[model samples]
Target: MRIRSNTGKIASVLIVVLSLLVTIPVAYAGDADALAATLSSGDRADADKVRDAGRKPAEVVTFLGVASGMTVIDLIAASGYYTEVLSVAVGEKGKVYAQNGAFVLKMREGANKNDNKELHRMTKAQAVKSVTDAGFEIVAEGEMLRNSEDDRAAYVFAEGMRGNTDRFVLKSRKP
Candidate 1:
């Protein structure tokens, strides 16, 4: 019974993953160092660098349809991981609104909150349902956006990003 249940869970997860793949578009096409290079950019913080392996920042941002000059809201900015990535992706003119969940907000009210002030360069606010209600449709949401490791575009520049040869695809959508 346990074996059967585990298999069922795996199958269900696979179904969700496959559905995400169908909806999300690739961010890297004929591009080479461009995609990986952006992820590995020195502009990113050292802390963010360590998280790259697990978070797959490049793939995640691209999947969200993030581009230079986008006004993005990092719904849950826990220590600004994705917020930092969005900052770089959006460029100076563009903006990132970093909002923490209720727990994080309550924690921030504590005493040890040192002056890690750069986080404020981004606006702080929760993005309520208003934007989506105003005609913005969410393009994609998932843990991983790349269709497959063997896919040509997903792993092409992974080495440049640190021995990660995951090609990336760039489905045309205006930046």
Candidate 2:
């Protein structure tokens, strides 16, 4: 989905990783060199390239163990920086979904600028429960995306919060 929010750089980094592997021909999966190439490729915007050093998207993807032919979903993908990275990581065979909440987009419009009631975010416990309730077994939780400096109270899209907010990677398996 497309997002029109005035979300800053932090929104560019808000990624919720959900991965599922499948057998498919992936040319560049799990290759560090390939990831680096993707990052430096001329096709990418210079603005995105400037942030690569700090965001460490490659390291975070590797830490999450994402590989070729893995279906991945990136939630709150504002500038779609991670989405592009993940798309290349997954290769031609995999699928990547970049999602931005409707509420967030709507809130940015002039008509609903003050409509805070429509904004709903799940707590960590609630997020876990929602997945467990859906019959998926929790397999693992990845902490590579965690930032110790974040006080956990700042708005996720707040300035200076880029790559500094608590993010959970819930790996689950079906019975």
Per-residue lDDT value at 27 in model 1: 40
Candidate 2 clash pair list: none
User: Number of clashes in model 1?
Assistant: 14
Give me the displacement of residue 90 in model 2, in angstroms: 2.2
Q: What TM-score, to 2 decimals, does candidate 1 have?
A: 0.45
Give each model a TM-score.
0.45, 0.63
The prediction achieving the highest lDDT against the true structure is 2
* Model 2 lDDT at residue 84: 90
lDDT of 1 by residue, 41-72 (tens): 66777777876875576665555456655565
- Candidate 2 residue 55 C-alpha distance from true site, Å: 4.4
lDDT of 1 at 87: 67
Q: lDDT at 62 for candidate 2? A: 62
Residues 69-163, candidate 2: write the lDDT tens digits.
87878777666888898887787778888888775455543643443221222345655676667777666776656566766666655687755
Which candidate tops TM-score? 2
